[model samples]
Structures are given as C-alpha cells and as structure tokens.
Target: MSASERYTFREVTPADLPLLAEWQLRPHVRKWWDTAEPFTAQKLKDTRVKRWIVETTQRPFAYLQDYSVHGWEDHHFFSLPKGSRGIDQYIGEADMTGKGHGPAFIAQHLKALFEAGVPVVATDPHPDNTRAISAYKKAGFEVFGSSQATQWGLILPMKVSSSS
Candidate 1:
C-alpha cells in the first residue's frame, strides 16, 4: 500500500446480505470464518456489534465487525480496558489477500476508533493463523497474553493502544 491509499467502512445493510453470504462460502473465507447463517437484516440491526463492509473506494472486498470487549459475558477479550474494542474480519475477495489490504484497512479503521476516543483495540486470532497475526502486527498490534481456549476457540490475544 502507498501513503496515499484510501480505505473506508460502511455499515452493512440488508441489501449486503447476499454478497456477504456469497463471500462467506468462498474457499478463501470459509476456511477462517463461519458467519453466513445469522447474517440477516435483523443481525444488522443489532446495536452491540458495529458491522461494516470494508471498501477501498474502488470497490468492496471484505467484511469487518467491531464491538465492545465487554459486550459479551464470556468473551476472550473481556479483560481489556474499558472503551476497548475487539474486531474480527476477513477478506471476501481471494485476490485481496496477501496484497497488504488487511493491515492497511485495519490500521485506517483503528485510527478512526482511536480518534473517536477508544483507548485500545484488541483481537484474538487462532494461534495458527499466521496470516492474521502478521497483518495485525503490521497494523501496530502486539501479542499481550498466552494463547487460551475459549468458546471462540484457541486464540492468541493481541492488542494496540491509542497512545502507542
């Protein structure tokens, strides 16, 4: 990505369900995500999770969701500080991965959250998901805890601070 590259996120709408479902079933995405079933217009109306279809002005290519770490009672990221958010996302387009879109878009989104007064951003990726770990590292996230097994699966907790 270049310094001038642009990224944006728009709230997922009911009209986006089919495309999201299509993406969720792709080999590239299906390997890491299983989000197709509950992805209805009603799911979009949930106030807790802020879901977005990630875009690059040129086109949309991914799905991303961020929510308060404490929103769920037993979430792996529950120990993060107040106002901290946890994110899960995947590139829908096979061509978009390995091209730096993950880090670039994630960093841009983190910047927006930080500017909006979020003190920290956290993510817990499967321990073996090297691609995701690498992208999060490039986005300024650092591993902060040992990997643990939870309802979400085995995750290696990672985080980035607004002040960092």
Candidate 2:
C-alpha cells in the first residue's frame, strides 16, 4: 500500500468537461459511475455539493464529489449526524486503478473534511462493487448494514468518524 502517495484536488469547472467525457466513456469507469451528464453545468452551480478533479504526480486521474447528506430531501443518509457529508468518486484513468491511490487519496480527503469540522464522512457504494467496498474499508470506513435499495441505488452504506 503506497500509504505515502500524494494527491491534489481542484474544484471542477467548465473547462474540464472534455476530460470528464473521455473518462466517462472508459469501460472501467463507466461500469460503476453514473452518466457523464451528472456533471452538468447546473450541477457545477449547485451549492449543496462540491465536485473535484483529483490528480497525483502523474496527472488528473479521478473525479470526487462530496455532498451534504441533508442536501437532498429524504436522502438515505438523512438520519446521519447533522454535520455529516456523503462522498461519491471514481478513478477516471483506468491505469490508475488497483494502484493504492484510491484509499490514499480518500484518507487524505477525509482528513481535510474532519479538520474543517465535519463530524463524519459517509459513502454508499453499489452492492456489487467489491472493489469500491474494499477500498473504502482500507480508507477507514466501516460498513453500517447490508445492502439496501434507496432513491439512489442498492447501496452498502459505510462511514468514518472524525474521532477515528
């Protein structure tokens, strides 16, 4: 595990659409993520979520987004603590997968969130996506319950506390 690997994040912007489009078409990414349309201009303007482009020493290779758990009415994470946030991300560069980057970057991002006074950070991976589940575990998230369907999809909710 390259625990020492470093990554940087910058907020997503209109100029990133082409890279995002190309990445979304890759088989590895397309398998687990929603359509490229999710990052529409309207989304960039949304106040409830923060979209980011993650890069390592190599290049910009992933997309990560964190949203207020209560941002959506009746959201499944609604019952979590008031200061809780939810994360969803994917490695856009296929070559970057299985390289220990996911957990390393996620852990770093979680640290930033906690430092910013977030009480908890949550994630819900698709039930069948074992890769994501394993990575989340490595990054310090604990599974809360079995897979369950929600307005989002079949999710295996997991979380890490600021105290942890």
lDDT of each: 0.89, 0.89
**What lDDT is obtained when candidate 1 is compared to the true structure?**
0.89
Q: Among all windows of ten consecutive residues in candidate 1, which has the lowest summed lDDT?
A: 29-38
* Residue-level lDDT for 65 in candidate 2: 90
Q: Name the runs in model 1 displaced over 4 angstroms.
A: 1-5
Estimated TM-score for each candidate: 0.94, 0.94
Indicate which candidate wins on TM-score.
2
Give the Cα-based TM-score of candidate 2 against the true structure: 0.94
lDDT of 2: 0.89
